[model samples]
Target: MSAAFDLEAIRRDFPALDQQVHGRDLVYLDNAATTQKPRAVIDAVRNFYERDCSNVHRGVHALSQRATVAYESSRTTIRKHIGAHDSREIVFTRSTTEAINLVAASFLRPRLQPGDEILISEMEHHSNIVPWQLLRESTGAVLRIIPISDEGNIDLDAYQGLLGPKTRLVGIVHVSNALGTVNPIKEMIAMAHEKDIPVLVDGAQAISHLDVDVVDLDCDFYAFSAHKVYGPSGIGALYGKRKHLLEMPPFQGGGDMILSVRFEETIFNEPPHRFEAGTPNIEGALGMATALEYIDGVGLEAIRKHEERLMKEASLRLPEVPGLRLIGQARQRAGAISFVLNGIHPHDVGTILDQEGVAVRAGHHCAQPVMQRYGLSATVRASFGLYNREEDIDALIRGLESVREVFA
Candidate 1:
């Protein structure tokens, strides 16, 4: 691999990466679940709590004003990061799950009829699937799924066919968490737009791996989590077009969400704040902005190149192990690889890998539909990050060999 980036220097930024696990250096490959925090992000969170600890947008005190400024500035950072037209279009939520549920409840539910349909893909995480299912039950609407090929790419022909008069909205994942298939979202958005349908992109996995411009993609709504990109947990952002935010109802009712409260009628706040109810994750938002700044300093293009090389190397070497079968070989993949041994359970594989200090996710990955499609109960998934090195892949390969010998 080309040394375009100083990998050692980059790894030093993440304090967690310097530790030892089970008598070996920690090879953290569970980045799809959540990335390790960098010192910059940690300091940002600590600084906020120590110096600017106050509730936002309400108090007239100096601390509150400073808190409000920092909190809103993070919103501006996120807005520019995603190329969103206005910061008012960005609504803070607890996580990507909450963000998707917010849109399903606030935007889709109010307009949905008994027979309306929500189109999603077969490869979606449960966060994307369950919310729409809840909406379906409430409104008696139907849920339609776009099938994926054996290679893990979405069947675009099937997706186009599924869209019809009853299709109220389309929700799709920008990248498959389990498979690492980067869906052609820009084209999918265009297809949906032709029929006057709005599309929501689940970007939890894509935001860190790719340069996501909500404006360039022309997606109506995009949701992603902070922790997926080396930020703190319990915070995420939902980006909606200004018009949609203006039209959508508040997902929850609370102190800051309302302008005036009356028993008979309540006047709600404007777009962004209307959706953000109660006390927000003030420190988390600041940390997420700091994380974004760190990513910017590293440069996303360099990160992408580095990770792609890692993925390619791992892909070629992993299947060479006895009894190992690589799953989901999409032509365009990113950041993750899922595999299963011929006679070994994924949990067992994960157990053995962990003993060797290689952490990987081994389960349905909250995407049961994907498991059902592939006719497997689970798979061992090792997802990469920018801080990961070539040695991590080598360690994983050696660990898998040990697993094979034990099973043999």
Candidate 2:
């Protein structure tokens, strides 16, 4: 542990980590899927329900005003968290999938011509891949994939070669969810910029673990989910360049997104408001902001150091297990670690670990291309979080022993 890393105190802030399952203390290693919410986030959600349960942007009542302030204030917090140029660039969405889809539908779909290209990496989640595929089917646009090395890192030289005049945009994952491979996004974005191509970063897996500055990175767009960052599910945000957001049409047409409506014609509102249609997730916005604040209080640098230690320990120890082969041996990694035990299916490994109170993810993790790259269908993934400790890794190893015994 790093100096002054009060692991116990950090663990206590998350109530879910204190509980047990199958009569053993829960060692949650499924953080890459969704992190357990901290008390601050939970409390913020509860307080909203108890006090300010009103729709924002429509109501004239006190509750509505309070909800509106809190909701929009959360947007400001998100804007600051990502270092976006303006709050107007941050549009709330259902999740990262919706955020990416928004860009696909509003920004790119109409502009892309037949035979135009959309480039993404082999390690992208389905959310990033499917939208481009759908765009291809609809508009006759071509979708190209940048292959990854055997170690799961995106091939920069290959990516540069693939960038051409017809390439409309590049969508890259900031971090690999299944492999924990952290892509050098800043460099990649710069390369795309040289070709005058916009880049969209799938930041769902990177936001909680890394220090993200959209301004510094100069990415055209960034998509991420609150659930992955210790906040509520069903809410996420997209940070688009102000220029792009202004040029793009609204993804959805509904109440707040319109400035005026008549039977004959309708006029739309400005950027963020235009993108966000209907009643927004008021409580969710508040909760996500609180989660961001909690992370700030803990200090991202400290959290980074702590998780680095855990990753190093897991790297050294997982290889010790019999017939186990770690996957995604990238040049750089963070968050999740995946491996397969010989003669054991990943599902079986995950199931047996669950019996010993170790919660992990199994299967393709929504990255079938990554699975295809390795010529495998699935692998077991143990992901980490701020609340996790080295003891959790020890417990995970011990649980694997149980899995081995069961199969034997």
State each candidate's clash count: 0, 0
List, residue by residue over 236-266, the lDDT tens digit for candidate 2. 9999999999999989989999999998999
TM-score for predicted model 2 compared with the true structure: 0.98
Instruction: Candidate 1: list runs displaced more than 4 Å.
Output: 1-4
By summed lDDT, the worst window of 10 consecutive residues in model 2 runs over 1-10
TM-score of each: 0.98, 0.98
lDDT of 1 by residue, 104-145 (tens): 999999989998999999999999999999989989999999
Summing lDDT over every window of 10 consecutive residues in candidate 1, give the lowest-scoring window: 1-10
lDDT of each: 0.94, 0.94
Candidate 2 residue 192 C-alpha distance from true site, Å: 0.7
Candidate 1, lDDT over the whole model: 0.94
